[model samples]
Target: MPSRQWPNILITGTPGTGKTTHAAQLVEALQSSPSTSSATWEHVNVGDFVKEKGCHSGFNEEWQSWDVDEDKLLDELELVQQAGAKVIDWHTCDLFPERWIDLVLVLRCDHSQLWARLEKRGYQLNKIQENNEAEIMEVVLNDARESYAAEIVVEMQSEKPEDMEQNIERIVSWVQAWRADYGG
Candidate 1:
């Protein structure tokens, strides 16, 4: 492996915006490259990591979700963050430190498209509506911009299959460029 650190890319967005899909594709693409063979690329799903690692303090009755303690989660992810080359997929972005993340891809979907995707997931009507509203409002994009430098944060549309492919290609190119510039 190169002595230079690899990038820690965060794929964050409103639920059902295809963050996981992008993350998985990114990992697969990177792992297939001979240049990146020495580098370790991990797809860290924050929601599942939190649950499996017991990083949350408690569960939320209203949302029916775990109340993730930012500090605890960070503590638990310390080693992974330090290892780098991580594709961190999560709905929230601001909790992760700016220094640890090299790129933030805030995936966005059209309100109607996002609504249908969430609905297909069997999400409650209220939850679906809430996520749709968040997408319409560009909450995740704004949060990513606020949490990371503008140069490091990108807002990409993922409403269609082509959009997702384009995103994956763009990030793959980015990784190639980064390796060329920084890796041995």
Candidate 2:
């Protein structure tokens, strides 16, 4: 890995764990910070991209299936390499190449809070139940560990934005330290 080359940091978690919010916060912070300016950062939300591009359709016509192209995404990883830093937002981490990732932040949410959030979205009972159960089971964290090496960090996020801010603080400092120690 080149020192000046951008670092790809993945922020993954179950739905309603605030992955998107945290990703946006981290990206904004990096762009505004003046400490180190060798690279730019971008937040890529895989699901949003898939939905926007209309990638896959399945049994539920209302809900398009997510069929991620790992190779294509890995090729896009080169964009982060060129930018020198990125905060990737995605629910699933196993889709990307582990070698290309510098760090993984797995956001976690309590099952009750997650269920409430999902309910607000008006998801079908079955989908909500499935997601709630997944959160309770720590599916996201398990998936991250199963797919990646031993450096992933897991943090919990409450329903409140303040809690999300705290989570972002931890990540911002982590990013700064990683860059200081690993960057040129």
Candidate 3:
């Protein structure tokens, strides 16, 4: 594939909203079913890379450490640009350059469901409440929308995996269409 035909897909959402899960599912689906042409799928997590590198000073004093410096993230994104047609997993979509992002999938979850998911993850009550409220307030989703073009899609994930799968399928088809339309 040509470099100019790269398709960058951004999968973002509030905490516990299934962004990573859906991103993984999308990658699997794409890889399992080969496209008519030479298109390929890659999944990149900005947060995990950041945490692995210990790039953030603010997180050093935390009880559990997960830090990704902004500068380091930019450096990693350079690799994603070259990878082409990849699914990016990160909490903050606006941090990336708009020129490289083609599609933004913002996962939204119900407050009660989100709280339950966080609780299941062993988060403290305060942390659960904070994430729930942040999601309800649309802090992350709004940030993605503000930074990207109007095509930013808002997908909802309920308490069931089936619900999540539906959204994933929708995104998969969207990616297929984009590839067809944009000459990817």
Candidate 4:
């Protein structure tokens, strides 16, 4: 199959917005459905991938996260992108080039729900506040829209289990549609 026939999806949002959960569930669902084609889809956790691939330049003490070198990360992602049908899970969206992504799903959550989730994860007070503020300001959503075309960027709320299920089903349908359109 041509590379463009397989869609590359990016699931991005603030830390507690359930991006990884959704991406994993979606991959499982797609894999189980025999009708969804034999082409395998990969869930690429950008954080873990960065560490495993040594794409970061250094560590950030304040955030307790890697100081990712964007260029290096992109270089590493090139090979993964070529594999196609990747569910790229990450917190930041705009760093990736738009042409490489077919869809950008920016998961969102209620501020209170997000705060509770972050607190449950044992995030520092300042870190929680920073994430809450970013969510409230629609930082990820805005960045996704700016980085990709409006038609391809979707902002969906993920505060409940039902929402997660619905989102997964919706994305499955989208993948099927994409396959039909692109001759996957």
Question: Which candidate comes out best when scored by lDDT?
Answer: 4
Go through the candidates in order and give each one's C-alpha lDDT.
0.87, 0.73, 0.75, 0.90
TM-scores, one per candidate:
0.94, 0.84, 0.86, 0.96
Kindly list the per-residue Cα lDDT of model 1 for residues 1-184, writing each as its tens digit: 3343688899999999999999998999888877675777899999999999998888987776898988889988877888779999999999987778888999988888888888789888888988888988889899888888898898899888899889988998888887787665
Candidate 4 Cα deviation (angstroms), residue 86? 0.4
Off by over 4 Å in 3: 1-3, 58-65
Candidate 4, residues 43-88: lDDT per residue as tens digits? 9999999999999888988987899988999999988898678999
**TM-score for model 3?**
0.86
Q: Give the Å shift of residue 87 in candidate 4.
A: 0.2
Least accurate stretch of 10 residues (summed lDDT) in model 3?
59-68
Candidate 2, residue 13: the lDDT equals 86
Compared with the true structure, model 4 gives a TM-score of 0.96
Ranking by TM-score: 4, 1, 3, 2
What are the root-mean-square deviations of the candidates from the true structure over C-alphas? Answer: 2.1, 2.6, 2.6, 1.5
Order the candidate numbers by lDDT, best to worst. Answer: 4, 1, 3, 2
Model with the higher TM-score, candidate 2 or 4: 4
lDDT of 2 by residue, 29-99 (tens): 87777754446677878777655655434235444246555566556555544555767888878877776
Task: Output the lDDT of residue 133, model 2.
Answer: 90
